[model samples]
Target: STEALSLLEASGYDYTNIELGKEWFLLGGEESVTRVALSKEVESGATSLPKIFVGGQCIGGCSELASLIDNGELDALMKKAGATKKGEPKKNTGFLSFLNL
Candidate 1:
């Protein structure tokens, strides 16, 4: 989650809503909610935490996030995801805002 934290920090995102991702287990438990949902959202053999989502879309973790930022696509995605302007503050509606179940 270190890499994920760095990426989010650089992007000016607060990690409070997503800390649940790290304290998770796949087994039956309350901690699994965020992790389980994130795992399913990512269409791959495996999904890792600090899964980045914008506009209710799973954008992958730190590496994928860096890729988007490098090509300036990150800004585009943020805009499409209803990101606010500078000084306007971005409100994270959290995992429920993206996934139905």
Candidate 2:
């Protein structure tokens, strides 16, 4: 998970690390942002975990994510998401706002 986040970060995208299962509740009181649960069960036939939802759309799992990144789709998506240059306030959302997840 750290590696994944680091890769995204190195690529100039904003991300948050939510360690689920450590807490008793699923949402862990952070309800507004999207929650992506990564689990082996979802990787199986369950079709639920590792679900990527950008602007409320269900993008697929690891392979799909990799494809997007490799093909420069992820960078374009992040730019559309209003991710600004480092140290600059991201349009309307602040730095902390991006990390609030």
Candidate 3:
């Protein structure tokens, strides 16, 4: 679980680790809204274990995350979350900038 979380972190995603049967309730709380949202993603078909949510959308598990990272799609989503890789902001340099306004 730690390794999986590391991959997400390495990919510039902000995530929380929840130990099932131990932190279940704690993760379900309002303070851990992202954790709860991730859990729902797992419950639904949107994502498997080690779930991820970007802007309230399920981004899927570790393997899926890896794929997105490999394909550069994960970086796009991270930017959408107002997050940066290694604390460096991502600049919109492509046609997407036309919609930035």
Error of 1 at 59 (Å): 0.5
Residue-level lDDT tens digits of model 1 in 5-54:
66555765433344553345444443566655666667782444556667
Q: Output the better candidate (1/3) by lDDT.
A: 1
* Best prediction by lDDT: 1
Estimate every model's Cα lDDT from 0 to 1: 0.57, 0.47, 0.51
Query: Order of all candidates by TM-score, from best down to worst?
Result: 1, 3, 2
Residue 63 shift from truth in candidate 1, angstroms: 0.2
Candidate 2 collision pairs: none
Q: Write the per-residue lDDT of candidate 2 for residues 1-101, one digit (tens) a residue.
A: 44444545676644443343423235533351333333332334233334444443445544566788889788677666665656666463422111111
Lowest summed lDDT over 10 consecutive residues: which window, candidate 2?
Answer: 92-101
RMSD of each: 5.3, 7.3, 9.3
- Indicate the worst ten consecutive residues by lDDT in candidate 1: 92-101
lDDT of candidate model 1 versus the reference: 0.57
Instruction: State the lDDT of candidate 3 residue by residue for 1-101, as single tens digits.
Output: 55557676576444445444434445545555544555565546332345555555555666776788789787677677665444454543221110000
Error of 2 at 27 (Å): 14
Which candidate ranks first by TM-score, i.e. highest? 1
Q: Which stretches of candidate 2 lie over 4 Å from their true place?
A: 22-49, 92-101
Misplaced by over 4 Å in model 3 are 22-48, 86-101
